[model samples]
Target: MKIEIAEHKKLAHSMELDVRWGDMDAMGHVNNAVYFRYMESVRVEWMRAVGCEPSPKGQGPVIVNAFCNFYRQLEYPARLLLKLYVSDPARTTFETWTTIERLDQPGVLAAAGGATVIWVDFPAQKAVPLPDWMRALVL
Candidate 1:
């Protein structure tokens, strides 16, 4: 499915993270691993916005594949604005898009990327078709 950011109502989601001294390497900026945490925040917020409860039982969307592109640097005590949206859902997977931007500069996007996640049956530990309720929400 294709998600158009312009068509959806803009929702605000943010996560405040403390910059651990260890987060900085020789370059003195947050390590690459931290970006993944930012992405996680966005995903959690997006799930909440769609009124989907996170399945503690693991019978929910599973990240079959994911990737991220970093455009800039982030420092200590940084507040990140995670903008997210859901695209179309396939038989077993759903597409999602996200952008991490600096709250201080609203127009400057720090990173942008997308992911493909598959719905799964935790009991069976296997991929499953998208639920009707999830498809309805995306549409």
Candidate 2:
């Protein structure tokens, strides 16, 4: 979803995450790793929301790359709205971008990240074409 970042529209399957005490680091704010976890969780949630799940035998989504930028610190007792979207779709992979907005702060961009996910045949240990159904949901 494109956040209120200068007119970009938000996707439909966004999610909210409650910041927990354990999620903070020694710096007294949310840790860097926690943001990635949030993106991963939201990606999984997006998959389920669309009623698509990878089979244990083969077809599944794998993130080959990822990164997050911390625009602001997330203190304890915060709620974040996260959204994910797919771009640069290709035969075997797609780029999933995520944004986190601090709801309490209003329009504050807490973080943004993206992961390159490639569909794969686990048993074959190689890349495979993205299923048409999955592509449909992403597009």
Candidate 3:
């Protein structure tokens, strides 16, 4: 998706990831599934950076929607710089954009993606409105 970094919700969090050899696929590049994990790492970190504690049982945000666009091949043993910024937050859901780039090539983006996650009431197995305290963090 086309996102202007300046237009994001202004919460910024960064993380460094070491690509493991096993993270590569037979095609000789980082596996697509690994990208999701990378993104998840950033999301969790962002929430922590904003001072939101994990749910009591350790369950966190639920992914209601997600998509990624691969711009370049990411190989193993490389350092990935991940940045996450909130996009928008509704009463029950929030969105964020994540960008992963090789540290060696800061300006060259390897992948870009975003996810929409909904707060959930686990026991009820249904969506729940974000609590006021949680919404305060994003705002």
Candidate 4:
């Protein structure tokens, strides 16, 4: 069964993850590219939670823009707590914000960024307005 948006919506969706050795660069800090992977992981998890999956036959979400900023060096063996929220919903796209914090340090921010996600019909290769369910998930 399809679930509607919660009456009382949460500000954001979050999860905790561990920094992997492979995610680091020769400099011993998390590589610049790895932050995006972390964000992608969170987004994919959210999609599953909200019952949206990418399929060629129907409308699926795609990231049209992605960005991140490093506040500090993220090393392996550290715990990362990440949060995601939506802002500025448009007809075919919405902005998603992400906050990456080091769980061990509590309030210390490791990085932050967001992406503009566009809903599209894969077979037609064009954009489509956000579906009701998808809007609910973002809001």
User: Residue by residue across 76-100, what tens digits does model 4's lDDT show?
Assistant: 9999988777766689998887778
- Give a tens-digit lDDT track for model 3, residues 1-139: 2335666566568899999999999999999999999999999887887676756454357888888889899997799999987757797988888889988888688998889988887766777788887776666
Score every model by TM-score: 0.78, 0.89, 0.87, 0.90
Model 4 regions more than 4 Å off: 1-10
- Cα lDDT tens digits, model 1, 1-139, are 2223656423334444445666676888877777776677778766776677756575688777777777778776566667766666788887776777767867576676767878888878888888898876555
CA-only RMSD, every prediction: 4.2, 2.7, 2.5, 6.6
Q: Write the per-residue lDDT of candidate 2 for residues 1-139, one digit (tens) a residue.
A: 2345323323636899999999999989999999999999888898888876778786888889999987888888988888887766689988787889878776668888878999999888899999898776666
Worst 10 residues of 4 by lDDT: 1-10
The candidate with the higher TM-score, 3 or 4, is 4
Q: Model 3: runs farther than 4 Å from truth?
A: 1-6, 51-60
The models' CA-based lDDT, in order, is 0.70, 0.82, 0.82, 0.82
Q: Score candidate 3 by TM-score against the native.
A: 0.87
TM-score of 1: 0.78
